[model samples]
Each structure stands twice: as C-alpha cells, then as structure tokens.
Target: MFIRAESKALNEAIAPALCAVSAKNTVAVLECLYLNAEDGKLTVIGYDNSKGMKTSCDADIIESGCILVKGMKFAGIIKMMPQGEITIATDERNNVSISSGKTKFEIAGMSGDIFPALPELVSEKGITLSQAFLKKMISQTIFSYAQTDIKPVYMGILFEFKDSELRVCSCDGYRISFCKAPFSSGESLTERFIVPGKTLTELQKLLKDDDTPVNIELTRRHIVFSFNGLFFFSRLMEGEFLDYENSFQKVFKTYITVDISELIDSIERAGLIIDDKMKTAIKFIIYGDVLQIKTATETGKIDEEITAEVEGEDLTIGFNHRYIIEALKGAQISGDDKIVMSLNTPFSGMVITPVDHEDYKYMILPVRM
Candidate 1:
C-alpha cells in the first residue's frame, strides 16, 4: 500500500483502532491491523474476532494496495515519528516502509486480504442520543459490570428502551447500577440487550462530551456505534440479564439523609483497616439522630459518627466499604445537598438518591464482607 498522510491524523486513527487487536491470539492475523489504501482515503481496521474498530482519514494515495502490519510495532513506530506528513508504502516482498521528515523505518507485514472480515451489522432497531447523555449512562453504571467467567451473560451491561427513555443497567451480583436518558422520538418498544462492559468503556473513551448526536444501531447478535468519525462493533452477550427491577418491591427498614461527600469520605477512611480477605466489612449503626460508621481488622479499627436525619427504628448493617464508597461517588449528587440512603437489609438493595432530585435513583446491595 502506498499512502501519504499527516502524522497527527495517522496517530489519531490508530490510537483507538488498536485497542481491539489481540495481545495473545492463537491466530497470527488477529494481532495485526489491516491497512487499506483506496480512493484518496486510508482506513485502519483492528479486531480480535469479537470486538472490532474501524477508522478512516483522508490521505494522498499514489497506489491502491492493502497490507496487515503488526499492531504493536506499527503503533510504537508511528507514535515516535515527527509531527508532519508521513509516507507509508509496501513492496512486493511484504516489507512496509514508513517515512516522515528525514527518518525512515521498515517492517514486514502480511497480506491484508487474509485478515478476517469484520461482522456486517443488520440493524433491526436504531436510536440517536446526545454524546454527553451516552457518556453519562456508561460512566454511571459500567464500573459495576460482572467479571466472573462462570456466567458469561452477567459480564455485560443491559440496555433497555421504552418509548422516549433509555436505561443502562449493570451489576456483578454484589451491586447494581442503573442510569437513564431521554430519547426525544422513537417507537414505543421494550427490548433488553446485554453488552459487554469493555465495549461500553471503549466507547466512553472515544465519544466526545460535546452536543453532537451519536447513532446506535443494533441487531440480534451485534451492535454498531457510529460517532465522531469512528465505528465500533461489539458482540452481544446472549441470555437473559437477571431481573433487577423486582428487588425494589419491598420497603427499606431505615432511611438516612447525609451529605454524599461525608458518607464517601467515611467509607474510604474506614475501609482502609478492613483487610481484603475479611471482605472490607464496614458497619453502619444508626441510633436516633447519630449514625456511626466503623470497620475493624486484626491490627486496627476506625470509627466515625456523622449526624443524619434518620427515620425508623435503630439498625446496624454490614456492607462492603468499597462498594458503598464507589456507589456514593456514582450517584448524581447535587450541590450542598443531603443524599438519602434507603436500606432494607444487608442482603437486599439499598436505594440512594439526592434529596433535591427524585428523577435519578441508585441502588446497591450490601455485601456480607
């Protein structure tokens, strides 16, 4: 392939695309990125048989050709090159040459025709959402995604749509997060699809936070996200996501309203003493208006009391301190406001929300550290 492109554009194109390249693959071609030069444009493609990415940029193409270059080697070389026009060409012997300014580098490549084809998406349902809204939904819930190999279905986030609202839910059996966004116009439909956390995370990194709209198209087995001159595809996790909404049917035994920052700080400070093997067991003891948060380990213990407007009888609940801390941080807490935590039991879901806004709710189940 013979192509001439600016260094910055080439680097931008490769940075996000290379993320899907397999670091350890049985198939040698999966470790390489396909570079195609055609019709005044250069396209870089990378995939590991499951997730894939494609990005294109305008370039001066002297000859139309295709080559597959090692992802790591190509990325490293391009990153170190000067910020100017770069010339890349592949010879008949399969040697790829890269030149910019006065420096030149050569590397071997495989024929691009041998690279596996990226999955072709068949869109049965499609929606458009603002980039900022999509980013928020991903950030608020993605951290709680399942990672265990036993249930491959749980290792992803659930996407649900109804009328003009979209919701993203994620959980790892310990805690669950749900975030919703408004869709201005769309057919009234309710469909649940599970998407791996890694895919949403990659989108979060690439999607801009501006007001641009992003198009999301989905079929039975795959999903495609096109935004900001980037195309991302991910294999959907098959099987049913556990029924999350049913957990909210019961009432909480105790409800406490405290500052979000205050509770987060207390969890962080108290969790330090709870060793990993012991499950970071931090206890919340509520008596009248005083709420005490404490944790103990073999070597040390931390205890702190925060005044809260508590309701119902006194209760003490044990929970994973790290989970509570992270959950508190994820909630969309408002300025100088008290956040409410409605607790039913350590085994049940605890609903959290800012006192000022009822539109958003965060639920996290207590871990029996």
Candidate 2:
C-alpha cells in the first residue's frame, strides 16, 4: 500500500482513533492502527474489540492496499514530520516506510486482514443533535458514572428519548446525575440505550463546542456516532439502568439558597486537611441564615461559615468531602451563580439544583458521622 497525505490533516484524523487502541492487549493487532488506502482516501481505524473509531482523510492513493501499524509510533511520526505531504508505503514483507521533506523513518506493519471485524454501521433508528448540546449533557452527568465493574450497567450513561425530549442519566452507588433537553426528530421515535462511560469520555474529546450536528444510529446491541468524517461505534451494555427518576426525594425539611462559588470554596478549604489516609466526613450545620462547614481529622479541623437564605427546619448533615465537592462542581456547570440545596434529614441525600431552572439535578448521599 502506498499513499501521500498532508501531515496536519493526517495527524488530526489519527488522533481521535487512537483512543480505542489498547495499551496492554494480548493481541498485537489490537494495539495497531488499521490503515486502508483505497478510492483516493486513507482510512484509519483503531479498535480493541469493544469500542472503536474510524476516520478518513483525502490522500494521493498510488496503489490501494491495507496494513496495520503501531498506533502510537505511527501517530508520533506523522505529528513530528514537517508540514507537507508525507509518503507512506508498505512492501510485501510488511516493512513500512515513512518519508517527508528530508526526514525518513521505517516501522514494521501487519496485514490488515488479521484485525477483528468491526460491527455493522447500518441502522434504521437514528437521531441528530448539535455537538455542543450533547457535549454539555455528558459533561454534567458523566461524573456520577460508576468507575468499578461490580454492576456492569452502572458503568455507562443511560440515554432515553421519548416525546420530543432527550434525557441522560448516570449514577454511581453514592450519587446520581440527571440532565434533559428538548429534541426534535421530525418523526415518531422512541429509543433507550446505555453507552459505556469510556466511550463517551473519548467521544467528548472529539466533539466541538459548536452548532455542528452529529448523527447517531442505534441498534439493539451496537451504537454509532457519525460527524465530520468520523464514525465512532461501541457495544451497548445489556442491563437495566437504575430508575433515576424516582431516586430523588420530592419533599425536603430544610432548604437553603447559597452562592455556588462560595460553597465550593468552603468545601475545598475543608478538603485541604483531609487525605486518603484520613476518612473524615465534612459536617454541615445549618440554622437561621448561616451554613457552617466543619471537618475534623488527625491532621486538623476546619470551621467555616457562609451566609445563605435558609428556611424550614434547621438540619445537620454529614457527607464525604470529595463527593460533595464533585457534586457542587457539576452543579456549577449550569452557569448559575446561586444554587438551591434541599435536605430532609441527616441520613437522607442532599439535592442540588440551579436557582432559575431545572435543566440539571445532582444528588449526593450523606455519610455516617
């Protein structure tokens, strides 16, 4: 296989695909990037059996063929090369040569036929959304995704589409995040799917904060996202996600409205003295119009107070420092200066929402003090 491509365009196309290349895989082919030169285009693919990405760039195709090259090494070579046309060629023995301007390099490649086949890209069910909207939804809720594999379903974010509205929900054992937006498909369509958190993390990096549209196709066991000459597909987790709609408490005994930045700053100050070795819970003492933040550990203790609009009964709650801080940060993403915190008791979870609208909701369970 032989082809000539511009260094910048080739590097940009190869960057996102590398997210699927396994760093430590038993199969060598899974660690390499599959390169197919055909129809005057250079197609690059990276797959580790579960999730993968494919992207193409225009190239001067000399002899159409396919080969697999080490993902990192090949990308590095292309990225460091001069800003000009790069010549890539492979011989019968799979010895690859890369040359541009006066610089040249050679690496070993394997036959692309040995790589695992990707899932079919065709799907009857599909939806289109703006990249910016999708990116914001994921950013607000992905933090609650389970990092462990104890429950396979919790490791993904649930996507629910119905009645011209789209909702995304995610939950770790200790907290839950929910976000929704209006969606128009121009036809009657209802679909629900869970995309692995790892896939969304990588897809978020490739998505731009603009109005560019992204087309999403969904099947029973597979999902595909197409945009800007890129096709990303992943296997869906088959299980029932948590019923997040009913997880949040509807009634609260205590409610407070406080500045988001001030609350985050107070929590960060309390976290400074706590570490992994010290499992101390941050205590919140709310009464009248003052919210006191306190934490005591082997290292030290912090007693900070911030003013807020408090109503209902005075409540005292204890929570993990990291969990509350993360929940607060996630709430801040709504671009709101003030947030409302609703609480029921010392044991019940605390709910955080924006002052104006309910576009996002985050809940954090308190810890035993």
Per-residue lDDT of 266 in model 2: 94
Kindly list the per-residue Cα lDDT of model 2 for residues 105-139, writing each as its tens digit.
99999988898988876687888999999999999
- Global lDDT of model 1: 0.83
Give model 1's clash tally: 0
Q: Write down the lDDT of every candidate, Cα atoms only.
A: 0.83, 0.90
For each candidate, how many residue pairs have backbone atoms clashing (under 3 Å)? Answer: 0, 0
Weakest 10 consecutive residues of candidate 1 by summed lDDT: 329-338
Candidate 1 stretches with Cα past 4 Å from truth are 24-26, 333-336
For candidate 1, what is the TM-score?
0.94
Best by lDDT: 2
**Model 1, range 234-325, lDDT digits (tens) per residue?**
99988878787775535878889897887877888886777878686788888899889888789698989999999976877888777777
lDDT of 1 at 77: 98
Off by over 4 Å in 2: none
